[model samples]
Target: MNIPEYLTSGILESYVLGAVSDEERREVECLSSIYPEIRQELDRLSAALEDYALSYSALPPIGLKEQIMAKLDFGTEAPPVETETPVVALPADSGPTYKITWIAAASLGLLVLIFSFFLLSQLRQAQRISATLRDSNETLQTEIQRQRDIRQRSEDLLAMLRQPEVRIIRLKGNDKAPTGEMMVYWHPHSRQVMVEIMNMPPLPANQQYQLWSLVNGQPVDAGVFDVTDAPQKMGRVIAQADAFAVTIEKRGGSPAPTLSSLVMMTPVTS
Candidate 1:
């Protein structure tokens, strides 16, 4: 149990104000008896509230007794009217008791009002905590799902690479980019193609890298890709190609390749 957290949780204030449910009341009582610090704090709060109530005690108005007596008929001969109910007379010494009862009732009412405000504050705090926890749980779930997808993609890529029919092509830098390099995986039977960036220079925001398959001296648009370390799947190579090349293009690939922007190229081998 985190003692400091429990101490600041507002349960003690609720317990002292007599606003806690029976189960919570019992928990407070049990914990207070077991912990000296809790007991001391509970006693201090009780004393403080008692002092506060006494400070706000209502006092009787001045000359109240005299005013009441002045309004009564003290003359010996007084007319009496017949009534269905009999009038009950109070004992002469009931003044002090009545005064004490009235003060006690007023103090109880003030305590009740204070307790209501404290409980409301506690409820608002609890609602905020609940909302924060709900958001955190949703974020955690999204991250977990993202990781699962990444793992599944990695496993699939490994399986594809192990196939006997797949061919590996290493494209080296051309005159346009002396240090750029890339790898291409091609499955002739399935016509599937995947590209991996080994090394590449960064491009401008408005430009991306495009893959081209040269067939009968004509460049075919394979796909466009971003510069990332992960292996990316591209358009299938339906016909056998003589070579593969990469070029810088607009955000999306164009119908024809820009020969001047060629960065890497590799000729196919039998």
Candidate 2:
């Protein structure tokens, strides 16, 4: 409504007497904020009521002011100091700008450091595990290589033994070596008979044991051999006959075995 119409509605009289309803108070407060004239009128109305009230109380008994002041002071020598200072305490976990930012940054940094330490520790542990696994793999590879070598040797021996024409000969201890024993294998097709000597100590570096194949009544040099065959494969080949022998011959072997070194001999089966 227009200002004149609002004034004519008798609402200004109610406002002047503090009788404004709650709804009317809100409307008047909004209008007063928007309109300078309305605000001025409200201010003037408040002054008028104040002045009217003062005029109405003018006949009050004198000495009322003195009575009010005397009761408050009790006639003390020093006036009391104002003990009530208004303190605006901020809420917890919230406050000034510098403090809030500092707290937030410090909290984030601590969390990052903790996580980084944890990640580093895990990485170190994983490296240790990888090293252990590498060592284990190397060990397994070494064992596999050794097994392969042994299996190959065994397979070679088995293939040789399967030949039907392979000869087997036994050599008894010689007269000087009463209890010494030996054997010979003569595979005619392969022409590779082996000699096995028992308790024949390791040969000197430049010396070796010799084998002899007796043909007719004469001793013929079969070949020289070493420790690899001394225990399981031994002996000689006789083109014409039936006997084999072993002796501590020289390194290159003797066309004829030294009689004193004669260690063992065997006769072939017909």
Candidate 3:
């Protein structure tokens, strides 16, 4: 059940004040044994009531005390004495009783103070836990959104590859690297281009693979790319090209292709 809501519904206060029905009283008793928060609240409420009662404690009136003493003197079962008897009663000292009463009151006040401090500490600890849970929940939501975005991108790429009109160009290895092979998916209708690295030798840290579009018998820089199993988008195909080629270049690529570094090229068809 919603324990916090139940506790804040003011039913516990009625239960503490002894105003609840028998059923409710039993329910509270049963839950107190099962839930620590409920039990702690019950204790705090009871302690508060006891402290209130002690705060207003008062002695009996003087007239009421006299009547009580007179009744006690006459109601005794001792028989009346015929001879005169001397009444030698010494006055009683109530110093110890008064001191003990104050001591008990002081101890009760101390206990109430300690209970208040404990309740405050628990409240602070609960707030800290709530804040931590809130932060963790936010982080989890962000990660979930990120994964969903990645999944959508993968689906889009797969859809592009399934298009029958998309041109699949197989670029073969050249003298620079005999075993290098790569595939380029050029979707002219959608103006999208992607590259799949099948087998390409790894390059040094300061070098990377770059793609070039052979347009009008001239090499136009498509973009610099990396060799990964997953398909990587090389931006849109802006120029009409007869064939595509791959070359190793400086890390950030160059304005024009480096012919000596050409590692692969699309087959020349006549």
Clashes of each: 0, 6, 0
Where is model 1 poorest over a 10-residue stretch in terms of lDDT?
89-98
Report the lDDT tens digits of candidate 2 across residue range 1-270.
Answer: 588646445455456555678999888889889888788877886786555444433232366445544555533244445986555443332223344444555555545544544565466668768888999999999989867765665565567679897777777776676776666767776776655555555668887778887778688788787665323343444455468877887887877779888877887786
Which residue window of length 10 is worst by lDDT in model 3?
A: 90-99
Best by lDDT: 1
Error of 1 at 97 (Å): 7.8
Comparison by lDDT, 1 against 2, better one: 1
lDDT of 1 by residue, 26-137 (tens): 9999999999888887898788777777766776677756555555534443345487455555443334433754577677867675876587658867976998899999
Q: Give the CA lDDT, 0 to 100, for residue 3 in model 1.
A: 81
lDDT value, candidate 3, whole model: 0.75
Off by over 4 Å in 3: 1-85, 169-183, 195-235, 242-270
Residue 216 Cα positional deviation in candidate 3, in Å, after optimal superposition? 5.6
State which candidate, 2 or 3, has the greater lDDT: 3
Itemize residue pairs with steric clashes in candidate 1. none
Model 3: how far is 153 from its true place, Å?
Answer: 1.4
Each candidate's lDDT (Cα)? 0.79, 0.66, 0.75
